[model samples]
Target: MSRHHDVVVIGGGQAGLAAGYHLRRLGLDFVILDARTTPGGAWQHTWGSLRLFSPAAYSSLPGRLMPPQEGQTYPDGAHVIEYLTEYEQRYGLPIVRPVAVDAVRRDGDRLRVESGSGEWRARAVISATGTWWRPFMPAVPGRAEFEGTQLHTVEYRRPADLAGQRVIVVGGGNSGAQIAADLAHETDLTWVTQRPPRFLADDIDGRALFDHATARRRALDEGRTDTGGVASLGDIVAVPPVREARDAGLLKAQPMFARMTATGVEWADGTTAEADTIVWCTGFRPALSHLAPLGLRGPRGHIPTAGTRALGEPRLHLLGYGDWTGPASATLIGVGRPARDAARAIAELLAEA
Candidate 1:
């Protein structure tokens, strides 16, 4: 028998789970389909030692409070996973785990979701897969020739793995800085960025950059200028941890690499540096290849939905998409509003049908 649901929320991360909680509270019948064997999408794949820069207050779900912590700094990945697991158990949200959805298509008035398990029918679909589904790695010449161990920041775990090795981290984003700083104590580290980062204070007014980005998003929307790129203000700025790394001399600002060799990386400015391992922290792309028949994507191949507008599709919705207003468009905090809007929209669509 084909399973049917009023709504199918894809990607059982913070966004999907939050939406599920809201939808259930509204007395709606829905099912969350997740790719991982368990919940906590990105957090599950994140480095084990990774910690949130934002304080516990900002990291809480919509209704529940994050467990109180003494330190003003953010909690680590394990703490985050624990909270997410508890949230799932607390809400008793129905989530289909390890069912990697391969594609979604519309059939008449219903939507069909195909995965390894089978097909599922839903009145509407909420794509809460989040933006970190695809890791972004630049294509550099001779990258394959580098005989040393190379891994993306997504696969990185602990510093002990890189101990005593000369590591080169690419990109000047928060992850790059954090990974480089974390490994510097036990390894020789060099950070390669396309450009010098715009450093912010370690702890701005006792708030982290993630929090500041959420608060400043409105200002960014008002002052935003088109740079002919998909990235917004939040996408380009450094978080608090990156700033701390710079202040502590754990990371040095450098230019992007022109090419890679077995020995080291060659920079655009005609300089070379040796590294035993390379960690690419460039960024990530949306994993939307599984979504077909949806002409809602933009020129850059990202889902194009503006400020909860629903993009003219009655039963289709996008969640956790970045660049809606200002810089923090892709953060977990930014997704809260959109998730609520999407849940409401899905409910209204079903009610009308």
Candidate 2:
């Protein structure tokens, strides 16, 4: 007989873990299905030096508090993974790892989730696989003909890997800045961006500005008071570490490239630069291929779920869909409110059923 569950959550990352934790508290029968061998999702795949911009206070899972890191401004990736592993052990949440989901389809009134080893049926499903599923790489003319190494920021590991190479870092986001700054110590680097960057201030005193936005977002979600629009890093968050690279001239800002040639990149301003490696720090796309029949995606292929309604699907919901009513939607802190709200909504649905 095939295994059955009350609810099945895909992806064992922070979002999925949050949902599983709440389901357990509600006394619901559920199981968490993950592709990786362990929890922490993308954090495990990130560069070893990665850390959360938000403080430890805001990074905790549902019931447990993240261990105190008094003097550290941000918790590193290893710390995050350690905390998540502890959270799993504390709750004894059922998580099946190394199981890659092949497809998820609604069959009659039940949803079928198939993996290489077996299949699972559930009355409801939570697609908690976060947005970083797919990395976005822009198509530059003649890119295929370039005689050099090329990789996405997602693939970059450490600055030592780029030693003695002429590197061009593309995109102006936090990852781009941090990577560029780190690489400047060992390589000839140039930072290229299409838009002028909007910088945020470093953590003030001991409080991170990201914490304030997350708090406000939670309040607005709970219907406390009208907190106004979603927050952008442009307003308060400090410019990331890349600004230091610009000051040292190791990194020179340039416009979006007009085109790419076999020899080098051509900027819109009619200038050119040669590079041995190109790192595209572009961005990411939501991973929702498993949610095909829902018909929820917009023109850009992102799900159109609004205000945690699950886009009108029965017992189907999302936790961190991106800035629903607040300024930031992609951060770990930003997703907490929605995760809690999603849990409550699922509990209510189970009650009604």
Over the stretch 186-275, how does candidate 1's per-residue lDDT look in tens digits?
888887887776454443421355545554555556786433332233332244555566567777767888899998888778789888
Q: lDDT by residue for model 2 over 246-350, one digit each (tens)?
A: 566665567778777776788777788898999998888777787776566666876656665556576677665466422343565555556666667777877
Q: Highest TM-score: which candidate?
A: 2
What is the Å distance of residue 314 in model 2 from its true position?
2.2
- The positional error of residue 228 in candidate 2, measured at the CA in angstroms, is 6.9
Question: Would you list the C-alpha lDDT of every candidate in the order shown?
Answer: 0.73, 0.73
Q: What is the lDDT of residue 205 in candidate 2?
A: 14
Query: Model 2 misses residue 6 by how many Å?
Result: 1.4
How does model 2 score by TM-score? 0.88
Clashes of each: 1, 9
Model 1: clashing residue pairs?
Answer: 234-327
